[model samples]
Target: MPSLHAIIPAGGAGTRLWPVSRAGHPKFLLDLTGSGRSLLQQTYDRLVPLVGTAGVNVITGARHRDAVVAQLPDLPGDQVVAEPAPRDSMPAIGLMAALIRRRDPDALVASFAADHLIRGEDRFQDAVRQAADVAREGFVTTIGLRPTSPSTAYGYIEAGDALTAAPDAATVLRFVEKPEVDLAREYLRAGTFRWNAGMFVSRADVMLDHLRREQPRLHAGIEEIAAAWGDSDRDAVLERTWPTLTKIAIDHALAEPVAAAGGVAMVRADFGWSDIGDFAAVSGAVHAGETDLGIVGDPRDVAAIDSSGIVVTSGRAVSLLGVDDIVVVDTPDALLVTTRARAQQVKELVDHWRDAGREDLL
Candidate 1:
């Protein structure tokens, strides 16, 4: 696994989790799970064990560079690649791929989000190892989480025939968008669909080649920036050219198109996984207290009597009575109260505040 390096693109604002997750301190930086380690640190922890600190590179916004560096000590400073602006996942990942290609053409790169949570460490490592094996075979491989339910919140990966080289790895037929509940249930019943976890493994040259073919303009810009990455003029090149790169995710820029051409592979994963996109998800992902409530702060600070849901408090006592499936987030500047069912709509609330010119709350 010496040839393996992990890249984490950590730039999302996690607006759906506003107040707790602000633009200044995004979701990846906060300890959403009460594990003391931030999500980014947890992501780092997961990958660092597979590839040492030097082998893990972080691609984050310029604003978060220092914090990311602070969270994970002993990692080479240069490995914390900062972006001038958010051009989406494609450019962030593509830049790392280009950089890795320059250093080790044969290196295998695995991309995982900074905010995702995964359980069952051994199963995750096994899936990654298998995905890496499939990647070395020239396939743009992805780890597809086995569907636990008819979850419309996530996109689906359609697994096709199994590859002979790696029996546990299957040829990906296509990538499906987040479907309606009915369609999701159909996919669940088929058993051939897995939640698209957006985790990918591929050889550095292979990934760049796919990028070069599908998104030549974006690829060229990325290459230009990467060429100057090691030089003093790196900032000038990045500032000038990063804005010109296309704003697209890797799924559209690489995964879907590659999968359509029968060049994508899927490794089944059963490890408990969650992106924790909203408060509803947060309620489920966090460890429940004895009262069966998800508390992000001190459990003693929160008192619940025959109530449920999550309460993220900021050093204030929170009490719940006869409330069910509720979400109460208390911050110094603002507070959020909503139900788990309406959690996905929290981003809309953030937008409302933004439109109202309440940047302080954001």
Candidate 2:
């Protein structure tokens, strides 16, 4: 197998997980799993075995650059690429691919989001290895997680024929957006669909070629920035060219088009994974007692009396009584009180705060 480099795109405000996941400290920087390590640190831990410490790179916003570096001190300074502004995953991952190709054209690059959680490390590694192997065959490969439920929250990937070079891999037919509940159930029954976890692997050159063909202007800008990556002009070039590039996601810019052209592959991943997009997922992953009550912060600070819900405390002690299926997140500046079913709408609260001119709470 060729050498692999991992790119972790550590953007996204995680508005659904507000209060605890703020602009200054996003979901990726929080220890939502209660495992003593933040989500980004866990992601780094999972990738280090496959790509080594120096082989892993992180692309984040300029504001979060210091936090990302502080969390991953072992990562090289040059490996932490900070974007002056958010341009979505396409520009972030594309820049990383260009930089990796600058070092070694044949290097295999894999992009993983910074806030996802995966169980069964061995299975995750196996899936990534298979994806990398398929990538070496000059195909853009993604890890298609086996859907455990008809989840309307996640996008689906339709698998087509099996690859001759990689029997464990399947040609991607198309990428589907998050469907309605009824359609999601139908997809679950079909068994040919897998949840698109946004994990992608490809040769750096192959990825760049697809970008050049599909998004010429974006590709050109990244190429120019990559050329001056190690030089003194890096900052100046990135500042001037980045904002001029189109703001789009990698899935729209490369993955969807590449899949339609029969150039994308999928590796079936049977391991457990969660993007941890909201408090509901956090509740499922972390629990305080035998009940469904999930406590993210110190459990000792919480007192539950027949309450079965999620409770996150900052410093003060919280008492929950006779409340079922509720979510209470307490921080020094803000406190969130809602239910798991309404977790997806937490972003509205962030918007409301913004409109209310309470930027400090956000």
Candidate 3:
């Protein structure tokens, strides 16, 4: 097997998890699961065991570079590639792919999101190993999580024929967008559909080849940046060319088109996974469907008489009286009080604050 490298894209503000997940402190930096480690730290913990610290690289925003390094001090300073601005996943992943190619063209690289939470590390590692095997055979491989429910929140992957190189891996027929409840149910019944967790693995050269074919201009920009990566003019080239690249995601720029050409593959994943996209998801992960109130901060600071929702407390004491399904997030500067049903709309609140000139709350 070829030496595998890991690329972790650690962008996104996670506005829906606002009050707790702010622009400065994104969701990736938060410990939503009550676990001691932040999501980014946990992501590093799992991948380091597979690829080692040196093999893992993180592509995050320029603003977050310091925080990301602070969270994972063992990661080499040069390994954290900070983006000049947010252009979405395509540029970040592509730039890292280009960089890895420069280091070793034959290197197998896997991209994973830093904000996602996963359980069953053994199964996850096994799936990555299978995906790597499939990638060696020239297929752009992704680990497709077996859907436990008809989730309308996530995109779906339609698995096609099984690969001969790795029977557990299958060709991806198509990528499906997030569907309505009825359509999601239909996909669930199909059984061929898997949740697209945005996990992709491929030879570094192969990934660049696909990008060069599908997005010539974007490919050129990253290649130029990669050429000057270790040079004194690296920052100059990055700032000059980064913004010119297309603002798109890897799914549209490469995965979808590549799959249409019969070049994409998927490894069936049984491990537990969640993006923790919204406060509702955080509640679900933290509460685990239990009716009791879920506390993310100091439990001693909370006094609930008959509450049945999640509360992320700051330093102050939060007392909930006879409320059900209500979310109370008490930060020092801002307080969010909403029902769990309205958790997804928290982003709207963030936007409202932004528009209202209350940037401090955001």
Q: Residue 24: error of model 2 in Å?
A: 1.2
Q: Across residues 188-286, which tens digit of lDDT does each residue of candidate 2 receive?
A: 999999999999999999999999999999999999999988889889999999999899998999999999999999998889999889988888778
Clash number for every model? 0, 0, 0
Q: How accurate is candidate 1 locally (lDDT)?
A: 0.93
lDDT of 1 by residue, 1-362 (tens): 43999999999999999879999999999989788889999899999888888889999999999999999887889999999999999999999989988998789999999999889989999999999999999999999999898987899999999987565899999999999999999999999999999999999899999999999999999999999988999999999999999999999999999999999998988999998888888888887857668999888898899988999988999999999989999998899999998998899999999999998888
RMSD of each: 1.1, 1.1, 1.3
Q: Which ten-residue region of model 3 has the weakest summed lDDT?
A: 283-292
Report, for every candidate in turn, its global Cα lDDT versus the true structure: 0.93, 0.92, 0.92
Candidate 2 residue pairs in backbone clash: none
Descending-TM-score candidate ranking: 1, 2, 3
